[model samples]
Target: MRAPIKTTLLFSMLSLCMSCSNTTALNKGKEKLKARFEVAGICSNYTFSLIEGMADTSLVAASWTNPQSDSTYTNAFGVKNPCDLPEGLKVGDEFYFEIDSNRPNRCMVCMAYYPTPAKKLNIKVLEIVKE
Candidate 1:
């Protein structure tokens, strides 16, 4: 009886250890991905509006087209600012749009509620000559 009980206990401990190691490995992978995303930023000409359009007042709706690739990204929402841009944005203005690489679905600064790593978004204006 004692031998059987010890065997069961040992098996349970080994299983628990395996699960813990797997969890640790998963956490490490997530951390690596987060770090990879942190260093990347995208630059484009952002088009915004002072009045709410597709996005509600709680959201900041904007769009941008990549100059090099001519790739158009539309209806991107900016994250809620601690200090609001009350002056608002012009309909067509270029900016150094900060992007959340980790959350690939939406723009970094103007994002719809999604999986984020508790990181703040950074959006900056970019000065470029018009063609």
Candidate 2:
């Protein structure tokens, strides 16, 4: 009876370890793109530019930066689901900036994964005028 209980415990521990390893593997790529957003502020719309692909002519990259930092990050911001940005961003609106380690030369806006009124980061609205 004692031996059987010990074997069950060992298998449970092994299963937990395997799950942890799988989680690590899944996050490996994202880990490499981790960056720091030390400076925060609003910048003019002129600072932001979209780069389109030659083949699809779709949005391939979003490059922007806060003038104070003087650093730019040019990482590819894919337009795919879960990575898409809301439209209507404009100048004079506030945006937190971050530097992606993978593309240290370009600076990008930092936005929350989801809009919130809770303790989450606030998503600034770029007010639009009626035509």
Candidate 3:
């Protein structure tokens, strides 16, 4: 009886380990396909808009909107809030920004996944144009 109990415990541990490994592998694959964006040359005191694709509208849209204005400056895919990004971004989502580039600064956007929560990617802006 003791031997049987030990064997069952060992099997259960092994199964748990296997399940964890599978989840890790899946996350890695998802990360590999994640998206990244960057923008540079933003002048100070200006605003920008970030847009992400809308495929599964069910997924929450996360963004950081300027408090004084009605424009969204930063955004992340698969996240309900801009502050929830974990790392890099997922593919297919688009981000638009209107930055104040009087001084050089960096902006980023990305996608979110479970366990990690969200993946934020850095966006490098080569130039900031006025329209």
Candidate 4:
């Protein structure tokens, strides 16, 4: 009886150690993926009103409140721009926009939203121009 109890305790400890190791490996993989991909910014262009259109096309819209400042920016999304964003974005809102790397003046897509304002949002993408 004493021997059986000791064996069970040893097995349980080994199982628990293996489980912890697997969890650590999974967390490392997640961290690697996050580091490889950039989070352009939050999408701030899809507000509550514009959610219908985004839904029509199968897109997601959400509002976030800044924990630090207690300010809110509605409908934030991610974009590929890596610059000093506009004032609205500076306030912790993210803008989703499309850009043609070849043509700086043309933005193929544009979406802007703010949560507290509770306004309509629109996202438009221009047709691809053939060379």
Using lDDT, give the best candidate's number: 1
lDDT of 2 by residue, 18-120 (tens): 9999878655423212112222233311222222112112322334333455555342222112122235433333333221223322335455342111111
Candidate 3 per-residue lDDT over residues 47-69, each given as its tens digit: 22334333222222255443333
RMSD per candidate (Å) reads 14.0, 14.9, 12.7, 14.8
Query: Model 1 residue 76 lDDT?
Result: 43
Question: Stretches of candidate 1 above 4 Å error?
Answer: 32-131
Candidate no. 1 TM-score: 0.27
Find the number of clashing residue pairs for candidate 2: 7
Please, what's the RMSD in Å of model 4?
A: 14.8
Candidate 3 is scored at a TM of 0.27
Ranking by TM-score: 2, 1, 3, 4
Q: What tens-digit string does per-residue lDDT give for candidate 1 at 52-88?
A: 1122223332443444445444444433332322233
Clashing pairs in 1: 77-110, 78-109, 78-110, 79-109, 79-110
1 or 4, which is superior by TM-score? Answer: 1
Task: Give me the displacement of residue 27 in model 2, in angstroms.
Answer: 3.6
